[model samples]
Target: MTIRDRTAIVGVGTSRFSKAPTDTPMRLAAQAFKSALADGGVGRDEVDGLVINIGWPLGVDYDRFAEALGLRIRFADQSWTHGRFVGPTLQHAAMAVATGLARCVACVCGVSFIQERGLLGGPGDFEGTREEGGTHEENPVYGLTAPAAGAALSAQRYFALYGATSAELGAVPIAFRKHAALNPAAIMRSPLTLEDHQASRFVVEPLHLFDCCLVSDGAAVVLVTSAERARDGARTPVFIAGMQGMRAGPDEFLFATPGLGIGQQREFRYTPTEEQLSVYRMAGVTQKDVDALYTYDAFSPLVWFVLERFGFCGLGEAAAWTQKGRIELHGELPMNTSGGLLSEAHVSGWNSIAEIVRQLRGECGERQVRGARVMQWATAWGDSTIFHS
Candidate 1:
């Protein structure tokens, strides 16, 4: 009756990361879904289950998406997952298939974060009611104006605490761009070096332009079904070994409001360490079993936080660990083989999961982690998953 080993991700599809404005969100969703269907050898009519995310400005509800895709799904759910809540929607789709609520399920998302799409706005715009002067009083007084600035504050603390140098911090994006150079689907495949990363302008203090993820326009979809059914698909199935979602309280490090004493300090719970350990226990595996790592790298400092939280390194040791080339493609633990959100595309966390499925199926040609049997995808907020072939 457990969700473990009950269902498999049979197919994955993704549109090329671009800024040329090719299609609407619905059309993008349909394109990715069709590609996934072709990959799985499943027809559109066979899909009776669906899971969709309704991120602000990327609004494609379940019913409308179903209509657009010409699907009549019996089990459909909509979500608005951000940060650590990425994997819940996918897990719901898997559960539906496991319980026989539907046979084949399509999990899809279409995102366009470009200015021309009319989705642009200042920070916290998605939260609504951001009137000019009325909301200013309660706003934190510290420089937590945006995610990048918040990350900068965190990064400054990390550097001061860990004695990490700017060169060490610059290595993360350098490695990501190296990986992106090998991925044709990646948007920023141009060469990037440590020197280049260092020379880039600071979006915020201690965080450079290269350290941030691309603002992308693309769609990605994955098809899930019973393991037995997946055995008959066009490609190998990547089984969902385990998944867990974790969150922090408002008083926690990452959630602390600016202008408050707690927020001004260097204490942020960027990683849910205990919850991550619990997920490992639930999966009955340890970090030693993982063949590759896919972390949500919206900011490069996030990679450092992930490494330490996931037990790859001890507290304040991620910078030194990266300096040793421990996370490169040929290093001890290869990370972000598909370039992640940093270089591949930022469709929330969907692109990262798609890369995980591909690696497990042994579909990645050059950037492949050889003998990649089991892999982990972790988000900055705490959503984590383990997949295997």
Candidate 2:
């Protein structure tokens, strides 16, 4: 009767992090899909369901991808959320299998964001709309074009309220980049310091260039099957444990609203803390039980917010936690051991799932955290948040 204990990730795969050349989105998807199949020790014919994120620049059609991959799929669909879609996709796949709608599900996403012909460039040009319209465009015009801007504003507010410094924020990117230095698959592997982070160009005030995640061209796919059938597959099975998503408000402007006097916004939630706490409680695990952490680091401040939200530290105490080296490898809680999107290439947060699988399988090379039994991965897009364990 418990959904958390029933689903397992049997296979995980990803393309090398780099720029997409002449390859089309479908081809990129095929490569990732094949890699996942090979990793899972499952054949393409065994795949009964397919799910894809429709947020990338190349615009993936579920039917087109299934046909091109030669998969006879019984269930196929596309996700709407941006980077936060992966967890939901996995949830859907698990339900499909658990309900006998499909036996094996392949979830995939391909990004051409780093290419010259990418979605960041324009719309219809890509799968999603480029121009921010309706309530969505409200904040972007106020200079919140990218996610970092909104997060930076939050960072500013956190600092203003807690007396935290930018140096504390710098520690996250510095640590992640250092970890990436050891990860061969990472794109930004150079050693980083608080000085380096402070010196980096300002993407948005309070957020340096290094605080932002890279927009890279790549694709990643994972295969999900029944937990009972997982042991027969290629790799160790990482159980779903639990998954949840919460939307506090619509559009990006909600978080960016400046407080109007003492108690103007009494019910407004400024961060993803409540949603994250709910997921952790639902999963029946504590932050102390987690061996590793992979939070969406599209902006550096997010690390702090996640740390507080997930009960790693008290509210307004994330800066102290980072300053004490609690989040570094060999520390109490190692975070972003795969370099995360901050140091590793960003594939719309799919890489977070791949990294979690790698840690669970004990396949991560130099950046691996030893004896990692449980992991926490989170994603945030606009006002929506998704967490998986």
Work out the TM-score per prediction. 0.89, 0.87
Off by over 4 Å in 2: 19-22, 116-118, 121-138, 250-276, 380-389
* Window of ten residues with lowest summed lDDT in model 1: 132-141
lDDT string for model 2 (1-389, tens) is 65665767888888887743546666777788888988889988989999887543444678878777788999887877366566667778877888888889998887676554433323322322345431222143344445455566677777888798988888898888878888888889878977788888987788889888887777899888888878688778877776675344333233232221111234243444455366566567766778877777777877876666556776677888897667788788888887888888787777878888888788877777888888877543322222232
- Candidate 1 lDDT over 266-319, as tens digits, reads 444344346556667766788899998888788898888777766777777788
Model 1, residue 369: C-alpha shift (Å): 0.6
Candidate of highest TM-score: 1
Judging by lDDT against the true structure, name the best candidate: 1
- For model 1, the superposed segments whose C-alpha errors exceed 4 Å read 81-84, 116-144, 251-275
Q: Would you give me the overall lDDT of model 1?
A: 0.75
lDDT of 2: 0.71
Model 1: per-residue Cα lDDT at residue 174: 84
